[model samples]
Target chain A: MSSAEKPLIGHLVIVGVGLIGGSVSLALKKAGVVGHVTGVGRNRDNLELAQRIGIVDAWTHDVGEAVRDADVVLLAVPMSAYASVFAAMAKTLPEHAVVTDAGSTKQSTIIAANKFLPGPERFIAAHPIAGTEKSGAGAAFAELYEKRLCVITPVGDSSATALALVMQLWEKTGSRVVTMDAAEHDDFLASVSHLPHLAAFALVNAVRRQKSEGHDPFCFAAGGFRDFTRIASSSPEMWRDIALSNRDALLGQLDAFQQELNGMREALLADDADRLLKEFSAAREAREAWLAKHGDGL
Target chain B: MSSAEKPLIGHLVIVGVGLIGGSVSLALKKAGVVGHVTGVGRNRDNLELAQRIGIVDAWTHDVGEAVRDADVVLLAVPMSAYASVFAAMAKTLPEHAVVTDAGSTKQSTIIAANKFLPGPERFIAAHPIAGTEKSGAGAAFAELYEKRLCVITPVGDSSATALALVMQLWEKTGSRVVTMDAAEHDDFLASVSHLPHLAAFALVNAVRRQKSEGHDPFCFAAGGFRDFTRIASSSPEMWRDIALSNRDALLGQLDAFQQELNGMREALLADDADRLLKEFSAAREAREAWLAKHGDGL
Candidate 1:
């Protein structure tokens, strides 16, 4: 058995126990990595639910109270809410406490975190790949992190101890942890996350508009359409902030994809069935290989 | 109780017992919707499996042999394989038997089917909403169509008895079905299915090209990236046919989406965060509403 399989002992604090946060809270606590997880959220009902569920041994609305002497502090709130959250808790943070996040975008969070937190070195920005279509503390589950990736982004001025503690926490939750520079992480995520979001959003708009135009004649829609466009239903405020924050990188990614789409259009226009088939086959092979290799906690 | 909840009578003949066909076989047998289901397939192994699993009361390689005294004939092979299969069975088909399909593109299917089959009047084209990322007879399951929409396209001519029988079969299999024109169904499905496949393929190619250009980025791709690009792994030949068959419709859908994307780009270029957020919020709200009505099938 690995170290994670053994009983863990650490006091962890999680702020904003929504789907990702509450899930992490449950996963860490159940695995016994956390001695007593404490949840902090703006909603009193959420705090009560988190406590009743025992995702956290305790719950509170005060940031300072939540962070005091916490061995590890996790910010699971939206990116826009992080700066103020950090600002509220920085003063009372235990000097040795490791601060991290479960945010989607990292660079902006790191920059904002550095300005608000008492010690820039104490904060490490991390993005856990585990998520569901649901949200809130009620949506949180204990096994959310199993077999997923948790990317840790270390700022230039961040401390090694903070990074290691954050890594250790994710590992204990059964995650495969990796690290990258914050900017590089953001750039890559823009293509992977932001661009897909935009594509889904655009597709949804297209369908909605076409429906209005009364053009949908065949009605071949089924479960596939629903899944493909599901992300278009995500919190628009959160995604919009992400798009704006990662605008340049996402635009670059979309331009590159557009060129590919244009080529496909040309191929179709020319009735190049063979070429289109070949391209599709290549992508199919590439994608299946990747999915097979990454089967961790499916 | 609904008729679906009651036991089914009569023998149901399922042609081309591949994934959808096999599943229909299994579901009909399991739900007691039919006393017996006879399967026709080119693959000997599939026939064997069908017998072993009790999905079929009997099986045959010859299409004419299987359709002897049948109540319904369901074509479940790839779209491209339809012509040969239709020609093989059309002449020998039971005169009153209802003919339908589990095909993706409908308009062309109808046109080709009309020409090949003597009794186009007996044909109804259906597209089921239920499926997994998996395929083949081994992947068949009875519950696949439960609560899933089975979209039917009634083309130029129709036989009321045949249409009613086909609709009855779908209802017995637990499908909430809708009917639309073959041309319109093609248009809707292109936007919903074909275009998403193209987007996924293009997205994967964009990254592949970028990786070829310089950075070792694929190494850093996590679950979000994998899931977002999941559809890129679909059957290439299948997707290629879809693109080719629905080229005009896909192009129009793509154009509509591109215009919206360009609008978002203009907003970003002008640094109009307000407009971007507003658009994002609207999309999210609309999606959530749809999801609320449809359930979290995503």
Candidate 2:
């Protein structure tokens, strides 16, 4: 193979090979940048599915065994499992292996890596800002990260070589990589991702509570409600882990949103038409501006 | 022509020929059930566009003149314009004209008709639960209402013949017609539509407030945020009118939703992982059930 087409990773280990992890393996395979992928997960069936679908060259339930000869390792499990996963693979991880993750929250992963891994300096925290309401290996696809933003938050002691390799890994998946502080990443995600999911969950529950003996409010819910609540269908356990991992930032976002909503409720109660119009008009203008700038590709 | 192929209405007058009004006209025309459609709007340019696009065969700036020879008059204007439109068409409306509206809220339209129309009994309050986040005649299409729900709220004094004709009109556009109490329609729509819009608007504003000199929170927003806040891009003035018209019901919904959100906040604050999981799981289950039953067509 030409040097440009040479495999970037000799052996890749993917822990928790679900949507995010499996997609990374598939994407690397599609780019011909990985020699072999080892899928590690708690579920035997899912690991088998990943391998059968060619997302991984081999499958194993043992994380330590899977990462023993890895050139690069990706942790894509639920946030709640990060600590234990790190502990499981730390002792067996190769001295030269570069560790990274496709996590939603960066700071927590950084913390787990620093606490459990022998070579914390090699751990590059990343979050590919892409996914659907669906999960699991079956939902994984090579193009899942194409044209998406992958934010990398490097801790102070992070190895520059390892960071570059992790960056190249995501770039091979057709993602644009940007680096930011871990805390900043958490704050931004709280507003854009975590807050929206919580709002959706609350909205679905609110509508559900309104269901009485004769009236089913969902019967009248059409396109708008459907789209608004789509994220409520996402994995509850995964979201709970995210919420707890980024509790402070998420709680702050929720407070700000609650206050904004209360302002609207006050305007409605007081019959302040002009204020209501102004708030709604401002939101419409801002959203349109955002769509114009971003092109709505996501 | 055979009865099935025959025109249901000889002359149909549509006021405020925007998306909803224009779509109704186009669907009827496509079904060969409407003849000689007359478009009325404050904007001459939009009226001309509607006629040019064949959504209407004729155009007028005067509501009274347009409905003078009408077999059916459809008010598809903003809720704020309902009273004035009814007043304008009241005197010149043909005695046989069956007046109807494709408004978002039924109770408000019914009240406006009762207060301003010469033949209140002939006014049928209807809401076609279908549309995109688009406005104006240019965005309308013949297939907009197909396979959607059209809610009809017949007032106690509503004429049977007028109600039947209105139902037939929506049915011709391929809508599933259902009759409900005006107040009940308002309540259900508050939970499903009005409240969602307000929540979206609030969400956008909350995110916008997070913008600072070095950071624009919107830069990190992706597909989930886009879908969650899509309704925030709707017409502000139109939403303002709906909010005011459906004030009581929407306020009740807002209160319930706020309580639900606060409950989630409490769970997060207490670090009650089990409680958070339970709430999120319940929402996921309910939304999945709704999607299975409704087929997510919307």
Candidate 3:
């Protein structure tokens, strides 16, 4: 067979067959690079659905059994479950298998891998920067990762072969792979992703708290508020794990954001119209520039 | 002519014929409820474009000349310019003309109307809860207000005929008209519209502030961040006016939101995963309930 048509993975094991994992399986299968996909999750019904939908070739509830014969294992569970999942599969994981993850925070996942895996060098931490508010195996689609960015953060002892294979796997899924430091990835994501989610959640709660005396604030909420708080409808369990795992970086981001908000508050209280306009204008220009460059792909 | 086909407005004067005013003109023209539309704005090119695109039947730069013989005068300028615009047209405004506004904040517009209109009772203050991040006459469309909400907050002295005509004008644009107290409208809008804009602006600024040492936080921003900060790309001059006009209510919302954010921060700092999850889940539930009721319509 030509190299382009050769199967990159003989057997692929996905630890959590939710949106991210199911999408990866579908993308790889569509690319004809994976011979078989085994979805391993705690939810039996979800696993069955994944298999029925052809997202996976088979399903399993035991992590060790799934990883025992896996040529490549992708851990896509919530951050809180990563350590336990790692420990569960450590003993039975094939030595030849290259391990990777689709976690939001990389540093914590790397730490978990180092602590729980038989060979930490085989684990390549990655985060595909794409998702929707929707979750579950049913939300999975092959085009979910098309043209999206997947960040791979490798450590000092990472196996070059494993890293290359992981990069190639993500490339097969139509992602542009870039390597970054795990700590940097955590910090950057805190600013871009984690902090935005927290802000949306807090904004929703604040508006909800204002519903009093039969006056619903949400009644006046239109498109702007809907788009601003869309992420508030995301999976709370997954976000809670993400927030906890990236606590330090997220806290720093929160502090910076709070300071910025306080400045606006001060401008409003002082009736400083010029200050408010200047800040708002700067933000608009910055956002316009970003949009011009990135084209809002995701 | 039949009542439905008879023109509701013989001569419509639209001051500041940008997105909101131009859209209103186009919708009314499409509904066959307006005879002639006169577009007045500081930007000559935009007014010319509006006239050329049939958004208005005629174009003028002088508000006084435009409103001299009007059946209805719609002020669609920024909130900061309300008093000046009101004063500029007050002298030449026909005694029988019904003055209305498409301003963001009602209380301030009512105050401006009361202070500057020759006949305060003939002025009806309305806030059409519709728009895009785009501006200018080129962005105007007849269906811009379709399935949207337009709030009319009339003062006690507002003439009954004027209020009815103003409501009919909005209804022609396919908007559901709701009458609300001016103070309550400002408060509710602060919670939903104004505060969300501020949060988005503050978030963009916060991320911009983190651009140091060649690390751009915006580079890692994905779909969630893009949606959360979309309004930050809105007209700075317009949002500045809205924020300042609704200062007290917006400040209250900012305070409540800050408190909610602080609660989340405390939970994160204390490593209280349960607290974080509870808060996040509650926010998600509230947003979902709102979406269920409102269907995310603009």
Model-by-model lDDT, in order? 0.78, 0.91, 0.91
Give the lowest summed-lDDT range of ten residues in model 3 chain A.
Answer: A1-10
Once model 2 is optimally superposed onto the true structure by TM-score, how far is the C-alpha of residue B58 displaced, in angstroms? 3.7
Q: Write the per-residue lDDT of candidate 2 for residues B1-298, one digit (tens) a residue.
A: 2555657898999887888999999899888887689988888888888878889888988888888899999888888998899999888998988999988888878888889999999999899999887789999999999989999999788899999999999999999999999898998899989999999999999999898777688989998898899999888998999999999999999999999999999999999999999999999999999999885567
Query: Predictions ranked by DockQ, top down?
Result: 3, 2, 1
DockQ of each: 0.38, 0.78, 0.80
lDDT tens digits by residue: candidate 1, A155-271: 677787777777888987788898877777777777667888887877777666676454442234555666667677777778877887777888888798788888898999998
Q: Cα deviation in Å at residue B117, candidate 2?
A: 2.2
Ranking by lDDT: 3, 2, 1
Put down candidate 3 lDDT per residue, B1-298, tens digits, no spaces. 2555658899999998888999999999888899888999988889888988999889888988888899999998888888999999989998999998898898888888889989999999998898886789999999999989899998889999999999999999999899989999998999998999999999999989888786677888888888899899888888889999999989998999999999999999999999999999999999999999997574
Ranking, TM-score, top scorer first? 3, 2, 1
Residue-level error in angstroms, candidate 2, position B161 = 3.4
* Candidate 3 positional error at A196, Å: 0.9
